[model samples]
Target: MIVGIDLGTTNSAIGIWRDGTAQLVPNALGDLLTPSAVAIDDGGAVIVGMTARERQSTHPTSTVTAFKRWMGTRQTVTLAGKTFTAEDLSAIVLSSLKADAEAFLGEPVTSAVITVPAYFNDRQRKATRRAGELAGLTVERLINEPTAAALAYGIQDRSEKEPFLVFDLGGGTFDVSIVEIFDGVIEVRASAGDNRLGGEDFNDTIIEVARPRIDPEGRLAEVDPLVLHELLRAAAERCRRTLSEQEEASFTITSGDRQFATTVTAGEFEAQAAPLLAKLRDPVLRSLRDSDIRVETLSEVILVGGATRMPIVRKTITRMFGRFPNAAVHPDHAVALGAAVQGGLKSRDADLEEIRLTDVCPFTLGVDNSAPDGRGGFRHGLFSPIIERNTPIPASRVSYYSTLSDNQRNVEFGIYQGEAREVQGNVKLGSIKVPVPPAPAGHVHVECRFSYDTSGLLEVDISVPASGLVRNLVLMDDDEAPNAKEVEARRKVLAALKRHPREDSHNMAVLARAARCYESFIGERRDMVGKWTAQFEAALDGQDPRVIDSARAQFEDALNQLEGDRYL
Candidate 1:
């Protein structure tokens, strides 16, 4: 069976085609959404989802959540006695979901259509694909999360023939997309986002406001750094939710003998959140500019993600486009639902078979070229966008260049992705070296072809036109790119560590509150909470899950603990 998965930063969900309808499959605890967390057990087994999250309140040091933000970097998390790459942590989460899907269907599930943020760069996308592989699932296509949400909304009526904007603000990222639906095709004209900004920033604002009140000596000096951080995060999230309706919210922090109270008005909250709100405007403006679609051309604006529930976000969006945004679908579940619909389309199990999705590239990809000497090599290292932004996916483009110097037996190409005029500032995906027979300067014809598939990853093929020599390349320009031996060693180390999903203290407190807010989290949630808590304590007893497993288990447990009805 083919399933659609939304591997979100804060929450994850899976859906499949079932009984002529798309059904979101609940995890072992009977929850539709699962926390993207892991934990390790005393028995040296990896635990994922709820169990990992429950332990976070006590085990902050071992658990690693929000690793998605470090997807393309060399960041590593250490637990027990081992270190794990972000890709490895993600794989555990993906594998856990795969197992749950298999259990639900009573059969093996091999293929899937996963959704990622529209703004994920090439490296991040590749890392996602690798995570899928580690989970034993073949990713048939990697659709943008916002695009999938649009498909779900657009296909619902089928008669709604108009252009709409999708504003997706998730826990860790924000994406804005301009789309037009005609006939049965859904075309994403342009997409833009701030990978670093999202609901989390709003929460940060709350902390900033409450910090002075809580600690007269300042947050870092008066309260325990860890406790202060967690409390601030909680306060911010609470403030963000409260501002949705009321004009004000109160924040209270208690750590040991220290206690303080602070009240933030809606206006104050908006002011603190202004910087982040401003960041959102850029993506919207960029998407509109790229699509060349005027504000009036938009039929409606759709808000996706839990963050959109904020009044400030809605107001800012309306003010920017002069239109009321659509809240027809629950922001939290829309993307997952859309993914399920896409999965149905892929499986040919839905009446919406006539619908088609055409997504676009969010950024440009190109090879760095030397500029005129007088320009101080202005374009020399600058990224010359090969595939301009908004270009359709699964698309390929080629550019030709010649050797710059005589007897240049080999040429080096520094490939980058971004719209920056200076290459040094842009992300260098990787570099490629092509060999050529001795030739006079400007004589060697080198063809550089870049292909971006549905997964959003870039494949570059460099060929010497005359010699007919070609080579396929993978981009890895980061300083941390490992040699074969290092890669193998790291893999072995990861494999040896016991896996358990567990959350840190910060998220544990957050989940505790989320559970209380959602009514559906009555039975299984209560039981899972207790069981996972015991499991976590047991792992701690022996310093078990032995590093890798413990770290993995902590993450998984955190995700599971946070899997209340609030998200779904």
Candidate 2:
């Protein structure tokens, strides 16, 4: 059976196509959401999901979460005398989910339709695909999480026939997508996001607000830095949840025999959160502008993510669109639910015969070129765009160039991806060098073609058109690319860490559902309710799965309890 997986930063989920319907699979804990954390024991054994999250409060150094933020980089994490690339860590998470699905279905599963942020670039997308492979599953398709959420909502509300906006704010990333439902097909007109932004920023806001109260005299210098950091982070998270319901929340920090307490107000929390909220304004506006769709044309603005639960975020969005956003689908599970719908379509289990989704590139791509000097000389290394922003995916474009000097046998091209006009201002994706039969300067023709697949991964093909010779191009710095041996070694490590068959089933489904709900209600709560959430989360980290499970149930109950009152 093929499943749909949302490999999110802070949390991850999996779903399956079953009996003409899409159902999210619960993790071993019987919860619908699993924290995307991986913990390593001293013996080299690995733990994922709830277990890993539970260990975070006590064993912060041993657990690696939020590694999704470094997916395309060369950074590696060391644990238990073994080195793991970002892809390897991600594989462990994916493998665990795969094992859960296979056990639940009582059969072996091989293929899946994974979801990614619509804004993930070529390297990030490719890294995700590789992670899936390393986890022992063939990725049949990679759909954008926002688009998946929209599809899930579209299927759930089939009666609605208007275009809507999907504002997804997850634990670690922010994505805004505008989708149009014409007849039956779901086409994503435009998508944009700040992958670096999310609920984490809100936690940071809480920290900044509490900083002054902890060290009024700046006298706590001799304390263990790590301990102090953890306490502050924990306190920040606590205070943030508190601000949801009460006008103010206080955090107490204990360092040895010393204790410090700081109270933070909701207004203070909002003020601290304003910068992040402001950063979101431009992206939302840009998404609309790029799609050429006006706010009046939007049928509804659907908020998705745990961070969106903040009142300030909701107000900002409501004011921008001049409409009350739809809360029909829980924000967290919305993406996974949508993914399940797509899984149903892919597996041909749903009543719908075909489902098509088309997404756009969020940023522009370019290559560096030298500008001519005033004295008839030329300076090299300036960037020139090849594919502009908002271009449709699964598309290709080619640009031609001539040799810069006479009898030059080789031409070098530095490629980059970003919206910036200058190459230095953009991200250097990679580069390519083409060797041609010696020709006079400006005599040799080089054709550079860039193809972006459905998954948003880029492939560059450089050819000397005159001789019809072509060479495969490499991206990023040569020193940065992983060698064959390293890739093989990492692959083997991932294989060894693949999930087994005898895991919990119901819990996986629950975790997925809970995550979806968390994403949905995150934007709606007030200060009074936020404190209870903080205590509940703290209580959840006490190691007992049952306690954590009960805490989640109570948290959901509290959210439902406050649903009717729209204070924001």
Candidate 3:
């Protein structure tokens, strides 16, 4: 069976096409959403989701989160004396979701359609596919996140021909997609985004504001950087959420008999987040301009992703568009649901037979060429476009060029993808060395053809008509994608790690929440939390479901009263 998975930065979810509609699959904790966190327990067993997230404060050294930002890079983190690449961490999360899906379906599911940010370059895309492979699942396709959201929205309301903009701001990446839906087709006209911009940056902003006020001397960070950062992060997250609902909230962090707190108003927070919010404008305008759709002509501006819940974000978008956006789809669930829709379409489900979806190549694909510098000289690094950004997929385009020097026997093509006018500013996917017939300067003409399929693969073909020679190549970043042998070796190492029992997920989650609360509170409240956690531990030790359940409910209620409800 095929399932759809949203391998998100802050959280991940899985869904499937069951019965007549798409439905989300719940994890062992019976929750549809799972936090994208990985940790090694004291017993060296891997724990994920809520439990792992809670331990971030107490066990900051061995836990890692938000590794998605480094997906295609060479970043690595060491957990429990073992070093893991971004791909390795991602594979673990995907494996957890795969197991959850199998349990929910009562069958083994091996194939999936995964979603990635539209702005992810070729290397990032390849890295995502590799992560899926390491998880032991066949990745059927990689759908753009905003495009997937548009598909889910389009399917729900297909009554009219409407042009809309999807503003997707997730935890670690931001994307803007201009979409149009007519008849049975959902077409994404354009997409633009910043892979490094997202909600977590806002959290960092809060941390910066609170840190100086909390520890004026800056001694806390010096003692233990990891724990200090985690505590401040947790407090900042709470304050950010509280300010979303109210006008002001207290950002507090307690350590070693001392509690540091500061009151931050919503207005102040918005002002502080101004710089990050401003980065959102360029991508939105770029997408609209590329799609040739005026802002006034857009029927609806749909908001997706957890970050859009911020009041400042919504207000900024409103001011930009001169109208309120539609929030019809659940911010946290839209991508995964849309992925399930794609899965259904891949499976050719009877109910969605007539529905057609189209996406674009989000970046320009071209090769390097020398252009006249307008001074009778040549500029060696100019970029010539074969296929421009936002062009419909399953596309092929060709551009012709001539040899730069006399008696040139070969032309080297440096394939790149970007919006820059110069190749130096773009990403070099790889290069192809093609032989050409010897000739005078600009005598022998060479043809460069670029073909991009619906599944996001690129093939470049270079032909020299004079010699009837043609060379074709598939783009591959040697450093990003490892060979089959390397993949199998990494997969085996991951498979050897023990996993925490699914049946104990509830107790683990409760303990995790209590631990976070313990770190956040001080004095009398802290004592109460310690007492409650001890009681819960004793109940768990009794091995009685009735007592453990009662203890869990009480502990949860206490935490809810102390910290209010978290956004997750």
Candidate 4:
């Protein structure tokens, strides 16, 4: 059976749909929730979950937690002298969850549907997939955390059409999603969030207030930064949690030869967290505006994620909506439970067959263009959106463009993802280049189509009618691109290609690189590169190695002159 896993920042959980219900699986410690921590014991064995979490207080240097915040970056953590990427630690936690699921179900589990923050970008989503692969699980899907919570709440089971909002405040990220349920469909109307703001930020706020008293002489600076941070964070977490239900709490930590203590009232704690609480408003307002739903129209504002348990957070939601928030699902368990529902749907279980889920693209997808600068030149980096954010998925959108100069032989389209008005502020996902018949400016038109799947994979298809050339590419992360052997294996699994000489592989790779470079240039430089490409192709047609090599050298020189030391 396909299990559902919630690989969260503070905790991870596994569950499955069984007997018409989503049942959470217990870990070796007989707990449904497992702390998202990893450490190495003295024996050099990797430990995950509760045991590792407890060790954070004593073995702070050897334990790591909250790596989820760095999921898509180049950040690495060292545990017991071994450096591990955020993905590596996540894979360790996922592996542990997989074992727990297998033990609970009494069978091997090979596939899973994992949940991530709704605001996670392409890189983060891809990293989550890699983590699952490393754990030997086929990641069937990556559902947005808020969307999963809505599924767990069974909004799709209701007979009437109802609109609601999910306010998710997790350990290291916050997300807000507007949802609608109608006719067996659970549709997310919009999603917006601050991936860097969450419960940990609140913990940090507490740390800021308690640090001065805990280390009056700043002696802790002599200790390892990681150790000091973990100690303070652990203490701050306790204070934050205690203040959630009580009026006051003690923030205390022990250093080498001294112990420090400070008492913080709830009001004071709330005052310090005001800034972080303020950050939560924008995402909620953005989601509401995107969905075009007013506060009065929302059927409910459902709260999920562990941080939402904070009384201060609940009060903020109440004041925002002028009504109490819904607490139908357990704050910590909702995401994993909803993930199990998705797993059931993926498996086509009898109970969930009629419940369909549709999610929106949280960010805009488009291309960069150039327009007249009104100074006898052209301005570049203009963003033209094809598929706007909040559009329902699986989605397909098309936009048209034309050659900018007379007899332009090739046109390049840079694919980007973001809400930015300029390409410089957006992320360049990839680019597509298609050859066009030489013609006057704006004479040869090209069509660019983007198709995004539910799994978040994107395929770009470019068609040049004037030249009858079509190019299709599946965009992938720069670091996650397949190697030669993996490419060959994938090619074998898909439709077979027509047989070609071995040299074609080398030629194709070069041409592909050249096409990418073509997208990076504009005006006269673009024209020059296009001409060099044509000449290189002519040399290859001669089938003479000497001629091809000479032309290749010239081609390389021309590219280097324009794009020095820049990889295409």
> Which is the better candidate, 1 or 3, if ranked by lDDT?
3
Report lDDT (Cα) of residue 242, candidate 4: 84
Q: Considering lDDT, where higher is better, how would the candidates rank from best to worst?
A: 3, 4, 2, 1
In the range 2-61, model 2's lDDT, one tens digit per residue, is 788989887888888677667888777666777788877555667787666545544556
Candidate 2 error regions (>4 Å): 42-44, 80-82, 217-220, 255-259, 348-350, 373-375, 436-443, 463-465, 468-485, 494-568
Tell me the TM-score of model 2.
0.82
lDDT at residue 559 of model 2 (Cα atoms)? 51
Badly placed stretches (over 4 Å) of model 4 are: 155-157, 479-568
Count backbone overlaps in model 3. Answer: 0
Q: By the TM-score metric, which is better: model 1 or model 4?
A: 4
**Residue 236, candidate 1: how far off, in angstroms?**
2.4
Q: Model 1 over residues 442-533: C-alpha lDDT tens digits?
A: 78889999998765657899999789999998553244555656555655654565643332433343344333322223345545655655
Give one digit per residue, the lDDT tens place, for model 3 in 1-568.
Answer: 5799999999999999878688899999888899999999888999988889889988999898999999988899999998999999999999999999998889998999999999999888888988999999999999999998998888787765578999999999999999888779899999999999988899988887777887898668655878887888878888888887899989988887778999888888898899999999999999989999899999999999999999999999999999999999999999999999999999999988989999999999998889888998898988889999999998999999899899998899899989898899998898888888888999999899999987778999999999999999987544447889999999999989899778888889888888878877788898999999999999989999999999888888888888776458
Residue ranges of candidate 1 with Cα displaced over 4 Å? 39-47, 54-57, 217-223, 350-352, 375-379, 436-440, 465-568
Q: Count backbone overlaps in model 1.
A: 52
Q: Which stretches of candidate 3 lie over 4 Å from their true place?
A: 374-376, 476-480
lDDT tens string, model 4, 308-355? Answer: 989999999999899999988898999999999999999999988779
